[model samples]
Target: MAHYKAADSKREQFRRYLEKSGVLDTLTKALLLTSKDVVLVALYEEPEKPNSALDFLKHHLGASAPENPEIEALRLEVAEMKEKYEAVLEENKKLKTKLAQYEPPQEEKRDE
Candidate 1:
């Protein structure tokens, strides 16, 4: 999910709102089309939960999948950081060695 841009991530929320609004209007139209004393009842009335079996499976299965794009992006970022860190450490070691070669030797003080 992190790999998705802010706009793409909000697509789901936008779609939900769109579907909800459409359903509300559609239901009113459908009710008008119905005959007298014919009550249209939904077994599951809540929009928060999945209305169909396919939606239910998709929700549960997608949660545990290993080949997620967001996880892969994080792994790549970590590897890039590790390479940069290692290169800096090597450069620091080389700089310290060069610095030591340019330094004057310490002179021992004689006892007065």
Candidate 2:
């Protein structure tokens, strides 16, 4: 069934994520790989409702969840940097507008 295949695919994806997260040691990684194959077999036998592999991984891994901490830190840093950059840009724009306003306009040339 399509559902069975999707579940199997999700299990494989979770295994890959476990490997990629870099939080697992060799023993744990190997165990997870083995468990993934077992899960695939179980799902093929009896498929369950579709669930987000990312969410499942995040829940299981807790503090070791991929990208949460790092992303939060980067987001904060980016927000601060963007705020500073925008302030400078706004100031520059205001100065340019003031300069243009103060510049004297040329008079129209008289016809010969």
Candidate 3:
């Protein structure tokens, strides 16, 4: 069914996102740390629950998770760059419109 396929596709994308974010590896390591004080098998068993998984990981793994101050700085830089890029694009559009106003229109050619 199309619905099932779409759900499967979303699952695949989420799996890839988790893998790329290193969440999968961290969760695995945490789960393997069953010999330690924390019991992280809940992460594997209750992943279907809607909650802050990253927050959970950060709490248990401390600074080992992907998020940090350096990443936060990079994210802010990216957002600033995007804002500047949009502003430049708007200026470019306005300049092009002004230039078009000063130029004469060209006649279209006929195929006769």
Stretches off by above 4 angstroms in model 2 are 1-54, 57-71, 106-112
- Model 1, 61: alpha-carbon shift in Å? 8.4
TM-score of each: 0.37, 0.40, 0.43
Question: Which residues of candidate 1, in runs, are more than 4 Å off?
Answer: 1-64, 108-112
| The best candidate in terms of lDDT | 3
Candidate 2: tens digits of C-alpha lDDT, residues 15-62 = 675456442343354456665555444433444423544334334434
Candidate 3 colliding pairs, count: 0
Give the lDDT of residue 97 in candidate 1.
92
lDDT of 3 at 26: 67
Quote the positional error of residue 5 for candidate 1 in Å: 60
Top-TM-score candidate index: 3
Q: Give each model's whole-structure lDDT.
A: 0.54, 0.60, 0.67
Query: Which pairs of residues collide in model 3?
Result: none
- Kindly indicate the candidate among 1 and 3 with the higher lDDT: 3
Candidate 1, residues 28-50, lDDT tens digits: the string is 44434342112122213234644
